[model samples]
Target: MVSSDSQYSYTSSSDTELYSPAADIEHPSYISKILSKTKPDEGKARKSIAETHAEGIENTLTRYESSTHGIGPIESVLDEEKPEQFDVKPDTELNEWDPWHYPVDSETGFRIVQFVDNDRDDPRCWTTRARWNYTILLGLVCFDVAMMSAIITGDMKSPAAHFGVSLEVMCLCVSLMVWGFGLGPLIFAPFSEEFGRNRVYQTTLLVAVCFIIPCGAATNIGMLLAFRFLDGVAFSAPMCLIGGSLSDMWRNEERGSAMAIFSVAPFLGPVMGPIVGSLLSVKCSWRWVYYFMIIFSGCLYGVMFIFLPETHHQTILQRRAKKLRAKGDSSYRAISEIKTRSVKKIAKDTLLRPIILLSELIVFLVTLYMAVIYGLLYMFFFAYPVVYGEGKHWGDIKTSLMFIPLGAGTILGTLAAPFLNKDYVKRAKKYIDRGQIPPAELRLIPMMIGCWFVPIGLFAYAWSSYPHISWAGPAFSGFSCGFGFMMLYNPANNYIVDSYQHYAASGLAAKTFVRSMWGGAVPLFTIQMYHRLGYEWASSLMAFISLACCAIPYLFYIYGARIRERSKYAYSPVQGELKDPEQGIDSSAQDMRSNHQLSERVIDNE
Candidate 1:
């Protein structure tokens, strides 16, 4: 268990203890408790080979029944589809799945799961270009998912008019979608871990495509809102789980650049949505906006079905083990073969973890900070229209063009990723050279330098929107806001991923719940709030909130090791020499790696 106290002691951290962070083979992390939930005394005793085999067979069937592929693994059938999807691959990051592993090796009784040094088929073993293809594909799916959520921006007023309802009633469609997005990941994240990433993506998107057509076809605001909410639920998998997929394909050091590319999607989608919504509303009606979603997503789904392979390590290993079994080899089994846990236990843990995490002051603080930023971003769909269109008396298309500055700022901020990553690697190298445990705080360097600009940009945008100020003034300030958000978020996102490597999926799922909840809820009052407070003060109030949050990353960067020290999951239980904080990462280096292999159990013949 992780200590509640922050004043705990640490062991030595030498290069010789490189694998020290692995947990004890006997006691797994609490998140993993759902899979192998034997009594502690019984768990300490290794299982027999036959017991392992029986457990594997049962668990594999469970995965098969629930897996996204529905049929089975597609490695063999994918050969024909491989040529067009060239450079598709995985990466070499430290795997979070059962890192302290024990695989059944029938020939040698019990052993561990590991990749051969030259295993080209391993996604982690792929070339950089190949890995990027996998990453870019996932990012594209995420970008499109966000686009669907926000494409209603310009079409909002039109939908109300069509339904003969108030604007707030029609805005319920967006809010419901966001609320559905908040609810989605709890179901999807667990499914992906149980099955595979590709499976969740396929199933969710297929359901989403089906749900979207109905929204366009809807006759009443109620029907439209229902479809949009379900569409949001079905489409949110990419938003919540893409970070974990990126982790699967990239090491922590390389994650900054990839996360930077991804971070823009959520922000960009709202701005980009107005472009399509504005155009289609003029010529084709608001329904065409939903129609465009259908066409674009349908094509993307087709590409995905043919191209995306299993990326989760557990599922892929099971596939390999199954193939070996057909050839009369039974030495292979994944670490999850230890035992089968009850559905009750699994459900109890899954539903409660996000709450438990939020209970932690630090986790709550960071997650809240992320939610605030996301909420502000979502509210802009309404706020931007108010500021640029009504205030300036501009037409719909002209108002849509104004959003370009925010996108420009986001793109410019992403361009800073290489430097951020370079800085991370340089510092990481120094820690490695010192034989010190590298802290996840190294990723927050950008946040330390750039968080202040968030408030600054908000303040600038607030005061610049009047007729006296040129539109360029607000536009340039939009760029600053974009830059500031990117700077603040890139590090924040990467830090969470790095901090909760094992629970990354669930961690992010909980995050999305909060983020989307706010994203959905805040927009309801955005236009009203702006009217009540006036744009400058309303925007300045948001700026004040952002200014307060600027302290988060800096606080974590300083005391992060102390914070992680109290987390059972965060700090690897290793025994190594501790370095002073001023010197380097002083890790609790307990060799948490457990390799308890199953032995043969004799059975009496009837």
Candidate 2:
């Protein structure tokens, strides 16, 4: 059974004002006898009516006048009178909308209502500057939540002591927090799809803040662990949602610079956490870490509340449909409103999407690569302090300072944005000049180049750090790690968003789950691995594994077009147009516009 909101309603065939069956035809004896019945069972049949009748229904045709005559007499007529097609909106002239009857497709099992044109009110139609500002606001929220993951990583010894728990288990609190990142998106991503990104942001982030307070005041490891896990769940929102949000804002060609800036949040939080945490751990105590988070989050919440706007076009259209209904345009329905699921089906789909997406080869391979990268980064959560503090005999502050190189490298890597997107920009222009659209694989070029750098950075970092070497050598290697990370990560994330199109949030959710699962799992044995294998070999091991996956990008570069051709989730062009079934708009025109902008940019530069 499909469930619908108050604004989205199903009408009955008996409502002829919307649609009426063919008239002026001789009725068969059985139909005529059923419609000719005058002994209406009004007392028995009044309770179970199939449709609500409108005033216009009574005046339009004989079949609908039976609503007042009693359902008994009209029941057969209503069945026979069922129209072949339906009008979703009534007040507007049917001719005003193109292709009025949306036939239910076999894939979705429900017909969809779609926009006749690119509606100005749609978030997809917002100005570029306005859209980007929203992306930045989303990035800050992600940064705020992710910063807390590193809050305790810099200095866990004292927290274990204060809590009176085994240091390993107490440290597991942070690991478990990372685990929550994997699990949260399973629900949040789907919830965002059903609701909107802005709703998930406010609710989850607020709850995550509440969880932090308890961590600061926890009486035991169990309490801290529980709160941390919930916090991870809350904080995981940015990982799954932000990629989709950015994709919603910009064309694939235009997303490179925005993604460069947006991708910085995940790194910034981790980098900031260590620095700020080291200071707080030295100056005050572990509890103060949570206190500091409270202050930062409190402020972030206020800013986002004011600045963040809903960006999902379907969500905006849903509200518009609701408003149109209130104004008595009952037939006006958004395409997204067509497919309603019961709570059970919703939960089933929401939970199963990530698993199903993971099975997709592109999602699987890329997610695995990112997971390895994420795990290596999480492993650094332990590796950083050990290599710098214990290995180099540095104090808390200096150990934290060591992380700056990684952050610096990532920042410098942002320089690769224009270069990375050079292919996309050029390809887009050629297409526009020829009045055509570029293929989706154009998004993957920079990513393919970036893929090689991961192994290079790993090898550099693995070999450079030694007891005798200057800290600068390892610090500089950290820059390679950061730069290589940007080279691959920005493009991979953007590729998924561009390829998946409307389902970008769910695609990112699958990635977040894979990324966070490995991210969380790495720290569990990172110190143990270091103890067993030593630093150079361990980092080398990771690098070689990365080297093995290096083919992932190249393979995609060569075969991604074919790979996505089989993808149910991929919104590749059918013929020459990338169709938005939800919008009923052919993105061919939109693509040309974006390419036109790309051409202007190229011309200006030339």
Task: Please give me the total number of clashing residue pairs in predicted model 1.
Answer: 22
Give candidate 2's TM-score. 0.71
Best by lDDT: 1
Instruction: Return the TM-score for each candidate structure.
Output: 0.75, 0.71
Compose the digit string of candidate 1's lDDT tens values, residues 26-127.
222221332233343433323332344334433333222222211111111122321122110111111223232234334334333433233344565567
- Runs off by more than 4 Å, candidate 2: 1-133, 244-256, 341-345, 428-442, 494-507, 559-606
Candidate 2 least-lDDT 10 residues: 66-75
Candidate 2 per-residue lDDT, tens place, 91-139, comes to 2222212222222222333333333223345455577778877877777
For model 2, which pairs clash?
88-331, 89-331, 89-332, 113-335
Error of 1 at 434 (Å): 4.2
Clashes of each: 22, 4
lDDT of 1 at 21: 28
Error in Å for residue 487 of model 2? 1.3
